[model samples]
Structure formats: structure tokens, C-alpha cells
Target: MYHSSTFFDLLLLASATVILSLLIFLNYIRASRSKPSLPPGPRGYPFIGNVFDMPSCREWETFTEWGRRYGPITYINLAGEPFVILNSLDTTLNMLDAKSSIYSDRPTFPMLGETMGWDRGLVLSHYGERFRSFRRLLHRFMGTRAAVSQHHDVITRETHRFLVRLLASPGNLSSICGGAVVLDLVYGYKVKDHNDELVHIAEVASLEFSCAATPGAFLVDSLPFLRHFPEWFPGTGWKKLGREWRADTYKVVDTPFDYVQQRRVGFTAIEEGMSEHDADILKWAAVSIYFGEWRGSDTMVSSTSTFILAMTLYPDVMKKAQAELDAVVGSHKLPTFENSDRLPYLHALLKEVLRWAPVTPFGGHHRLMQDDIQDGHLIPEGTAVIVNMWGLLHDENIYSRPMVFDPERMHLADASLFMYIAMILAVFDITKAVDDCGRIIETKAEFTSGLVSHPAPFRCSIKPRSLEAVSLIREANLMEG
Candidate 1:
């Protein structure tokens, strides 16, 4: 009161001291409260989090190892983000299925979503009305029963086309087969020329996109603030590549859409109810448009590559498969869906391929819709969840010698009897099994994130179960027509 300046200075000092005391007290309280027992994981450095660590290759292996050391539910921090990896099948069942309502949504990766146009892809869509609509459409188009009923003739014809292409030039077999199937499915056109412009663009665009998407490839994704810079800015290669990819992608997408539109116009004379095939094509086109606009066409392109790659890497699996085809099909004909029932080995082999390397090694990342608790841990809302399909497929309990490419694990003698005898010939011959089936090789991720993760162009040799399998393929080709 005697001196106003002295009083003001004393008040300011008191305020500062109180604020400091409160902060220290809060920190002490936080430390003393039984800290949330997060599942065991490698300790992270302060502030930067786990960004400076976590190896790319064998990440799945490391996660599985941690699960063994810790528990089914585990967590990891990457760039200040928490990733709850469900290690056990039971945990996945509990979270993805039991708590699916809370966990089905895909995490928002600003760089991948807005920058790369993934906000539209099927695999990345959140759990909402639009996602439901797309899933319904896919169900109608490609679900087991629906796909079988609707696309039997088309798929069968395509498979025959695949066999013929392989027989003609096995070296270009992958490109040819993938090109033919994807073109017919998406574009309503067959890839006649090996170097067709559409096919070339499709392959290049898909490959580039995949490369851009691999985890840790783009720093902007981890440090999103970097994306604020202009496209021409230095170190922003992703922006430039993304634009290039979008342009090429649009070309592939638009070509198909335009062709279908033209095709529809040509049949304008037919009454709407008169042509089922026309209506189906129209519906298929709409579905493709919805998927393309939302999810991008890269997954279809990538899956197409996956089908071909599986055959290339697992030659022993395919060789045994061909041997089964030799006995059952007897060199007289190409395998058809009609023979699929008899081709149990081929059927099992297909499932094995999907399981063995799971096109999406780390199941697409999912986002928590709201805060929830599971197994004495807090699953904070918006926590990134990785399905860890790699762990599920390689689980010891699920598959004997999970690492081995033994199609016979899924074999059923009675199941094969209904189709070609060739299906059974090789799987039953256990001696044909390769001693070292080896581990799956990881490929770079694409801009799309989840879909089209191929095994980055690797080589593996094929040895037919015996001379008979090769002879059968040769003889079948020779006898045809």
C-alpha cells in the first residue's frame, strides 16, 4: 500500500511460484497413480517417440516375438502415435469382431488420404454408410457365391485365356495373366498386345504408387507438418510423384469408364429390362466408378499382380499342383471351375497363397472410434490398430510348421475326388515338398496404403514334382485344338 510498484512485483512473483508448484504436483500425482499397464514393448525415447526405431523387414516377426514375451495385446509408439497390435487370434477376434463397432474404422493418414487420394479406396474407407455401400457392392460382385454365380462364364473364360498365355510365353506369363484378368474385369477389354498402352500405364502407375506407399518411405507421412510446403519445394518428392501417379491413374480409370459408357449407348435401343447382361455391365461399371472414385483402382491392379506373383515364387507348390492336374486332367484339357472340385490341391494351394504371404502383410491400419478398455488396458479413441495378419497366418497353433508351403495341410482326399485326379497327385506325394520353403519377402507399400503390397519382384525357380507334371502341361498344350 505504501509503494504500488513494490506490491505489484511481489504479486507477480507469488503467481509464478504457484504455477510452478501446481505443475510439479500434477506430474507427481501422474507418476504415483498406478501407471496404465500398457502391454510390453521396446521403450521409446522422449518426445520423438519410437520413430527412430522399428525395423521395416520382419516387423511382423518382431511384433509376434513381443507378443510371446508380453501378452496377446501389445502396443508400440511410432512418431508419438500409439499402435495397438493384436497378437493372438483371440485378441483379434475380441477386438475386430467382438468390438468391431468400436474398431472397424481406418485411421486417418493425412498424407496418404488427402495427398494420395486414398480417401476413396475400399480397403481404407471408415466404418460408415459409404463403406457399407461399397462392401455390399463388392459382395454382390465378388463374394464367393455371388461371384461364382455371376462371373462363372467370364472368369472361366479368363482362366482359359490365362492358361493359353502361360503356354505361349511363360516368361511374360505374370504380366500377360494379370493384364488380361484386370483389363476384362475393370475395363471391359482384353489386353491383346503384351505392351498395350493401358496395361503398361496400369503396371507403371501401380508400381510407382506401391513404392511411394511403403512404410517410412515418405517422411511427410510421419512428419505431416512437412506437407504444408509447396509441391515445388525441395525434399517434397512425394508431392511431385503423387501428382504424376494421379494423372496416370486417372487415365486408366477414365478409359474403362468411357468405354463402358460408349458400350451402354450402343445398346440404348434395348429395353432396360430386356438385357440382363447389359444391366449387369451397367451395374458393374457403376461399382467400378464408386470404387475408383473412393478407393482408387490400384488394389485391383495389385491383387492382379499378387495372383501372378504367388505362382512365380512358390514353384514347388504350383508344380505339385500341376502334377495333380496331370493325373486328374490327364493332359487332355485345361483346368476349369468344373474341375475345381476335383482340383483340391489347386484350391488348397490358392488358399495357401493368400494365407502364406497375405497380400496385406500388416492388415490395413484401423482407427478407434471412441475410448474403450480391453484386457486391463486403455484403448484410447483414435489409437491406430494394425490387424497383424502376418502373425495370424504364421501362428504355430493354426498351422503345423506354419513356415512351410505345404498345401497338403488343407488337403482332403474326399474333397479332391469330385474333381480332376491331378489335384490329388502332388499333395499326396509328400516327398515333393521342398526342404526349405523360406520366409515371405516384403515389398514396398504403395500410396494406397493397404492394397497391392506385392513381393517386390523376387525370383524363385520351379521344379515340377517330377517329369510327369511338365510332360502333362506340354502334352495338354499340344493336344489342345
Candidate 2:
């Protein structure tokens, strides 16, 4: 008694169900054939595939633990997307360094890059002719140690200014010092004593970048189709935020660029005569140098803060460094780059700072361009590769006591860090702050979690070592001015 139309609908429904079953069977067969080749990781559920296993924060620590459990190269899938974490230096170098051609590309960041316009910067740019051009421009300017030495005076002068600021107010040395130096070098812009507009804009944009770039931060990044949704739609509030941040990001790039064009004083790769396209390349390259440093996760700022934290926690190490500074550089004048080679212990201390709390714990993620077998594991194309820099640096096999902050165990040189630490130590004594009740405030060694890591804010006493040290800091500042 059923109508003909009902019969037809039933037939169509049966046909669709059969097709879906066949497709699932085929997919299961292919996966069974390939499962043995993929790297070992935590077993995942049927459809979600390791989504629940991912940590919400401090992912580098979790990745290090995984390295301990599942070998150096560990693999995981997030809703069908493949991710590989390289936990050892050897594996990182072997894949990222040796296999540069196949691994140089960057994974697409839909939220930060496409929506917020961060892809134009060097950090997230795709690997291609434009990327090569940016590299060439940077190399021509300050790629070599010798080239860096040309700006030694600029660095020293800025460091002196920072010391003077620390003398006056002993808080937030990270942003002021890092932003000032990069601004001067990149845009010939001098930061004001308070409320620098350019610095404010850059900081805003940088924070936005960090939040948007965080993994699982935005669903739009995972589901590209969400980007096409109307802002009035439910759960599309992020689109409005993306638009606001996009404007600020452009300000970070354009404001300084326009200032340089007007003043003609900052470091510029642009020449008198060039095609518009070439000129655009030069402009972005220059901005990259500036943005890379001042972009909230500045290496200089993080390292400088780490240096303070280390000195506060280990007074014995600080006293030893001061003793060496007294004997080597003396108190009559501030330490300069020329004296770096003579201060072996100070050099070691700087190295230990870099190793103890690396600025970028998980270095930039590199995208794989093709399928390849590594260490008997099949790594498919388009895999997002991350190098666990923290794990590699803190490997117990490499260092006797990885967690301890012992400079004597280190033997490496970073010029800028050496200068910052040596200059600060020459004048300031960093110790734990004492409460009004005459009790020493305890400081635990804790750091922030992000693409760029810094020591969590802790109270510390930063003051001149002696009357003579105060005089030296003031004299150096006056001379620089």
C-alpha cells in the first residue's frame, strides 16, 4: 500500500548506505597496510585521533616526556593531521638541517598568517624565491660576526642607557631595553622615557600574534571553512578580533617603515633605484629584523630576564662573576665588547643562561614537503615538524646536571648576551628582595609558557655594587647622550 515515491526514497537511502560502507572498508584496508610504517605514539581513539592526549599548556615539557617514553622522533595525529616532534639534537639536525630542501617550508597559519597578515613577515613566510630574497638582504646587512661588530657602538650605548634606567627604576627591564635597541637599529627611532607610541603598538601586535599562533587556540585554524563564515554567525566572534589585530599588525610594519622613509636614518635595505616588487621585498626584510626582536617573545629580553633570575637564585655564582669582573674589567669603567674574549667565566655564564631557559623552547615548526622514511619510520608529506629545543639543551646525557645553573659546565659564546650580562654585572648586584619584616622573599624558578618563554615575574633587588659603580653608570650614560 506504500506509494511509489516512498519506495524510490528507500532505494536511494539503501544505495547511499552501501556506498559509505564500501568507502569505510577501503579506508580501513589502506590504514592497516600503512599503520606499521608510522612512528609509535600513544594509541588514539577511533575518530578523534590523539586530540585528548595533547596538552593545553607547557607542551614542550610534555614533548620531552614523550621523547623519554617513545624515543626521539615521536609521531601523533590530531584529527587526521600528522605531527612529528623531534626531541634530540641529532634527530633535529639530521632532518631539519641535513634535509633542508624537503623540510624548509613553513606550515600554514590560517588565523595569524592569512587573517592577521603575519605571513608577510619572515618567521612564517613560505619557503620560496621571496624567502630567499629576504635571507639575502638580512645576510648582506648583519649576517656575519664581523658585520655585527660594525654596530658594536650602538649596542654598547643602548646597554648603557638600559643600566641607567635600571638604576632609576628596577622593573620590566626586558621590554624597555629590547625595544629600545631594536628601534634604534631598525628605524632610527628613539624610545621616550615613558609611553612610547611605537613600542605600545608593537607590543599589542606581538601579543595578538602569540595568542593567535598558539596551537588549538582558534577553530578557524583547524577548520579553514570557518573563516568563510559570517561574523554574525554563532561562534564567529574571533573574526572581529582578527580584523582588529590585522590593523595593529599593519601598524607595526607600516608606521616604522614610513618613519624610516621620512627620516632616512635607520637600517634600510632599499636602494635609490629598484622595481616596486624588489622595493617591497626590502621593506618587509627590514621590518622583519625589527619585529623579530620586539615581537613580545624577544630572545634578548628573555635571556636578560633569565640572567637576573639566575643571579638571584645563585648568589654564589653572582659573587664569583663579580670577582672575575673586578679582576678583569675593573670598576673604573663599564665593560665593553673588547673585553669579552678575556672574561671566560662571564662567557660561560651567558651560555648557561641560553641553555637553562632557552628563549624559543620549541623552535619554529617546519613543514615537510614530501613523504620520506626516517629511522625506519614513514613520515608522510605535509607533516608539521617541531624541534624540542628545550629537550635537546637539557638532555642529561649531554650535560652532567642539566637542571643546575652552573656556568663552569658551559663553553659557548653569544656576543649580545655576553655584553648585556657583563655590562649589567659590572654595575648591578641582583639579589633576592627583602620584605619590610626583614625576611628574605623566596623566589621559585618558574617561567612563562609560549612560543617565547620568559622567567615569571619575581621580586628581586637590583642595585649598584658600590658608590663608584653608581658614578660609572651615570658617567657612561652621560657620555652616550
Candidate 3:
């Protein structure tokens, strides 16, 4: 009888286990059926899921093509992660702007943020109290046009110096001007004409950032668990690299910060007395201001470079701008912010530069905090959202002949870009370079592919429009000195 009872008990327990498993399976099926389907995208394989389909470079062009096929909002699964690409400006604004509460969060970058120590900076910082503190400090410093105008002297001086450098060595134009302006603005440290230490440090940090931040460049970014491996372990070479990059990252933040503390010069929001945490926030905020303007192609450097490239390619646009600049500011004096309102064509030209090569082809990724539905499709929580800024700017519906550089189509303006482009155009004439045979070297609108796109290096001649222009640049430089 005891043996019979044991057998019955075993059978009952087995039955209960089977019943529980069946119920759980039924619930899962029901939930799966109830859940909304994701938006249309290229079909993916079983386990990898669109990993191979993702473009290693020039992703914006691929995303744009997906937009053509799958509509404005295209969804794809990478492994288990959901990614939503917004190809239209309206959709990007609706999701990232209108629903910013959930869409403002930045995706975690294990390689760049955690290992390389970039999360301390504003660009890769997660959306939270700390991020808000950074924003608040920056806003207090230069939130408005009036606030920015307070530094007009710095801008005007650096810009004149840029003109001098361009006149001397046009080949080094890419590396010269932007760093000087930013370093002066941030630390009051005047960049040496060549081989500036601070500029080199920052440049190294920025290059590391680009490499580590590139998707799939480091295996640890995908398999974050790999970061736990010992440095001595095989295939752990990246750990050593990470250590070096982290050191550079901190150096870039601390070097100028220490300089500011020692001399008490330069613009700093950190006050005399504050809590340790508060002071740290202010420090990073100052560093952010430096990197925020200087690091990305979408900022002053790339925009100015694009302006130069545009002017070289489109002579008509350049002539129209110079005509406007001549009438408003004249050849005797370099254009100033005060003269901005008078030059409509130049304003339009600045806008065209931004639209033509959009420094950031893809806006930084925004992570979804909660599951949401839009246009009858589901965007799951933790989805990485990307806006194809290039596609939006080039959308055929929005601008006629979007590929062509036309200032007439633009109505908006960028202040820093306006200052740079207007000052340069007023003094210098940019044209295609001639070969040794005296034939004009034909160039196309080719640009580099990365987070920040810049016009590929092409031969272009940058010279003063007249001897008066050269005199004006020198006089302004001397006056600032």
C-alpha cells in the first residue's frame, strides 16, 4: 500500500508540472497574438536578425532606401534589439521632439561610455538629473543670442586670425581655425600657430571617440560581458586600448580645467564655493561646451568646411553672396554680427550650407524608455531610434533640386556658421584649383562618411579678393592683438 501511494504521488506531481507548462505556453501565445506588429523592414534571418543587412558605412543612404520601401518609419531587429529609423523630418520631430520625455534617453555605449569614460561628457550622457544639470549650466552661460553676443570680441578676433592663417597656408585650413576659437572660448588659452598641445590632446580624444563609438568596431560593444575578461586573456587587446583611451579622455577634460583654475582666466560657470558634486557638474559642463562645439562635424568646423566646399563648387552662389556682402559690409571691413540683418543672401547661403551637407547625416541615437505605437505599428521599449538627418534635408518633397546648392531655397540661418562663411567670403575668393597645365581641376561633391560628414579633400584656391581685403584682415588682427 505504501508503494502504491508513492507511485500515485509521483504521477500527481508530474501531471501538475505538465499542466503548468501548458498554461504558460498558452498565455505566451495569447500575448504574442495581442501584441502589435513592428513596422515594415527588410526581412531578417532567424537568430542574427538584420545584422548582416546593416551597412557598415554610409548608413544614411541605406536607411533612406529603406524609407523609400518601408515608409518614413522603418523598423528592424538587430539580434534581439529593435531599431527604428526615422527618414522624414515630420516623424523625427513627432517622436523625438513631441514625445521627448520617452525618446530623449541615449543608448548605452559600453565601449565608448563605460570603458572609455565618455559618459561623464554631455554628448553620451544618459538623460537624467545629471544631464539636466549639465544643460542648465550651459544654458545659464550662453543660452540666448544676447548671451552669445557677449563673446563677440572673442569670435571676431579668432575669425580674423583664421583669415590670416588661411591666407598664409590654405592647405592647413581644416585644422587651424575651429580649435583656436573653441580653446580661447573655453580656457582663454591661445592656440600656438602650429603644434598646440591642448589642441593635439583634444584631437586625439576626438579620434578615439570616433573609433570606439563606431558600431561593431569593438566586439565588447556588442558583447559587453567581454569587458570582464582580464587584460592578459587572449583577444583582450581592446582592454589595453580602452585604458589608453580613457586616460586621454580624462586628460582632455582635466588639462584645460586645471589651466582655468591656475590662471582664473577663461569662461567658467563654476563659482567660488560649491558642493563637490555641484563643482564636478560645472567642470564637465565647461568641458562639454568645449567638445560640444569642437568635436562634431555638425558643429562649426564641419559647417565652415562645407561652406568652403560649396562655394568652390557653386561659383554663382558665391558671387551672389559676395555681392550681398559688398553692398552691406563692403570690402574695407570684415563682416560683423551687426551686419547680419542686412545680408539676406548671405543668410540664405549659410542655410544652404547646412542643408547641403548636413554635418551630422544621422542625428545621435535616442533610446525609447517605454513601448509606444505610431502609425499603427509598435515601437518597443529600449528601441534605438535614429533620425536620418541627411534624408530629411534632401527629401525631394521638401526642396526642389535638393542636390544642387541653391541659397534661394533656404530661409533659416545659423549664427556661428553665418559669421564664419560671411567673414571668409567677404575677404577671400574660393575657386577650383588649376593644374600645373593651367587647366581647372574639376571636382564633384564628394564627402567623407562618418558620424560627421566633411567634404573630401579637393584642390581649391583660397585667395583675398583684393589687396584691400588682405589689408583689412591684417588690420583687424593687429587691432585684436
* The best candidate in terms of TM-score: 3
TM-score of model number 3: 0.91
Off by over 4 Å in 3: 1-34, 230-236, 293-298
Give the TM-scores of the predictions, in the order they appear: 0.71, 0.90, 0.91
Off by over 4 Å in 2: 1-36, 171-175, 232-235, 293-297
Q: Whose TM-score is higher: candidate 1's or candidate 2's? A: 2
Q: Rank by lDDT, descending?
A: 2, 3, 1
Worst ten in a row by lDDT for model 2: 290-299
* Winner by lDDT between candidate 2 and candidate 1: 2
Let me know the TM-score candidate 2 reaches against the reference structure. 0.90
Clashing pairs in 3: none
Quick one: best lDDT, which candidate?
A: 2
How does residue 319 of candidate 2 score in lDDT?
Answer: 89
Structural RMSD, model 3? 3.6
Ranking by TM-score: 3, 2, 1
